[model samples]
Target: MTTPTLGEFGRIARFFKPLAAGFPGARGLRDDAAVFGVPDGRELVVTTDAMVAGVHFFPDDAPADIAAKLMRSNLSDLAAMGAEPLAYTLVTALPRGLDESWLEGFAAGLGEEQRQFGIALAGGDSVSTSGPITLSVTAFGLVPTGRALPRWGGQPGDRVFVTGSIGDAALGLEVAYGRLDIPAQDTRAHLLRRMRRPDPRMGVGPRLIGLASGAMDVSDGLVADLGHLCEESGCAALLHADAVPLSEAARGAIDGDPVRLALAITGGDDYELLFTAPPSASDALATLAADCGVAITEIGELRPGTPGEVVVLDGAGAPLALVRRGWDHF
Candidate 1:
């Protein structure tokens, strides 16, 4: 028989079974519905994110990187909620002219991530699409009920925190689009890799368990993503522009003035976590960073809720305008 398009059960059984088996408590992918249970008194955290080629990934991306990033992007969502990964389900649409090689690379990448995180595939649907390939994955996790952080729990004085450097992906996109030519050696590799495979702050999630009042992953530009946090937390934010981390790679990619740099912040696809915790919990972050072995940066603080307003502050707390508005899915 010819290669078959994915039917409901067929595709789910094939892909999800393997993925589910990868996780410990993931019931066999053979039930009416996924029979899932969390630790008693612990709540479940679920998040979904979709990536479309030309929108999320370059049509010319290597299969392995695409698969890896796809999984990471979804997991990043759970990270924002301070959830430990349990399992996930993916629905992918493929373009025609499939090849075994591409599938192999894709599976290989997924397999690597599966091994890294104790998560398994659950189930999903797949089919041929008219244009670009798209992947939508829903990830599951367990968090203590009263401890899970969300995007709307911040108070006015909560200190804003971001994991790792920002704008690497934007710099990566510049290299991808031929806008910037990376010089040889280390910087080029750094920028390229940042665009391709982003490291999610997986370890930090547990530390944020009950500490952060509000949190989210920074898939959009930093400024834009920060705006989202403000909106969710029912507050406004004044960012110390000087404090916004900029990579040497990003700076080299974009010359003076953080205009182009700001673009990278709002351009999306960074996948870092942006969160808010009360100022009293400052030591918790430093200790958490040390305990989790990850770099955590404090960005800003939440103010009274005000929609449609974000001010980039100088070290002296003055306003600055930004070029890009960050990522939008519309």
Candidate 2:
């Protein structure tokens, strides 16, 4: 069956314009650029992320899931900096012969997430790509002046904490690739969902303003991202391998396999917040976790050592050597 195609202007009028209806700054998608204002005592936070069809996701993955993942991943960046989402601009480079239904599904997914996250589509460009479906979003958010979180704020003796379970996304990627065998249908579904649509810690980020010392979302491996924080903060981290939280599905998938456990620790795309806080903030952190309804687990601590060094100790309290720490796009 041949798929229908619309001209550029027709596509914008029919599909993309509605996404800008709620945001006055979008100018109803009629103007060449978007215009908006940031509140008087707040700073604007902007982040951009791009996803390729074969690189970031399977080429045949559902369009809706792809759209959701792209938007949420950028939102995770904003959350890492303790910002509240406001608006976003999207760029779509789609193949010439793609089906129109794919655009419909993609727009629907973005609309749903925009409503869920209280953000609106501002403005952007779309073009035909000779290669594959490539999408990028430049998300804008707001934070109080001088209150945005930094990667260099961690101090020695500060407790390292992570929001939500770790390694589920990596395991889910394995499930998606058919590399891991799991007999349970529910378990497979859980991991796959975690990979496809990450739950960004939106609620926890804004509240972390006065609490967390340093923070970054776990996009790369946990150990690698912690190393980045340590490098910025001029300290080293001692991570307790046993304390890193794992979902029941992830545990069952590992099944006491040390190799799989290491993959879980080093594999990237978890998107959970890895942060540090002083011991004095423990009670406040516990209360914030309960109020936010998210699991915040203490996995390690910063210490005086070589910067950017991350030491992962096993349950026996000995360092465990690994082949690689995280993903590298280079």
Candidate 3:
């Protein structure tokens, strides 16, 4: 016998409404739109990111992880703007025959992140789709007036910094694809986690207000994203290959293989923040990293030259040729 299906309203009332609990602005997901007053002395920052099954994530991946990734991806944008997350709206398009259990897990994931990041689900829409699962999150954050980091403020001689080690997510995708043979289980597990879960540098971004001249999250590969910053700021960049921080797991994967190193450089999906600051603020940034309990590394510098030019130099001062910069939507 065919089973009954949970319609849109029923699904929202059963799974999503609880996720919006305690947020008066959400109006229990009953209102047409959420309403909230911005706190005094702060401005709102909004960003949206979308994830699709088989493109952004594996089709069989955990519902919760997929939900978390979508939320974190949007949150990373807010972090790049030096804002703290306040609230978010989620919209999900589910494939035909989607199980109620899947919705439960997805909502649970959103609920968990809401509590962890001190945000709430204001409202959202859920609909069934004939194609793959698609989820979008529009996150809201707040920053002090005129303190949000500017994407176009990077200047020549500004030191480039990145939060946490790089390239783990790229290698993590390799692990997910079963292409890499990592003998160490710990290393494999680490890479897998990096691919499945991304950490948005929310704590560090706030401390960078008025300190960083420019900032953005590294959604694309490092080289490609930095090139974007340069193009926007009308500057070039000279990146030291040796200084690009790598996790122990990534190092192991790249050991003795220069191609693997190149993958680390060009492979995308890292949600870490990439920001430019003056030399004088280096010490302050260091302190901020310490306080945030996340590693910050100096990888390159902006230079006065052709816009969109990104040069990667080896430790011996020789330029390294890269075939691809990072993931491109086109």
lDDT of 2 by residue, 188-235 (tens): 999999999999999999889999999999988998899999999999
Candidate order, lDDT descending: 2, 3, 1
Misplaced by over 4 Å in model 2 are none
| 1 against 2, candidate with superior TM-score | 2
The sequence of per-residue lDDT tens digits that candidate 3 reaches over residues 174-250 is 88888988889999989888878789998998888878899999988999999998999999999999999999999
Question: How do all models score by TM-score?
Answer: 0.89, 0.98, 0.97
Q: Select the stronger candidate by TM-score from 2 and 3.
A: 2
Q: What is the lDDT of every predicted structure here?
A: 0.77, 0.93, 0.89
Give the winner by lDDT: 2 or 3.
Answer: 2
Worst 10-residue lDDT window, candidate 3: 1-10
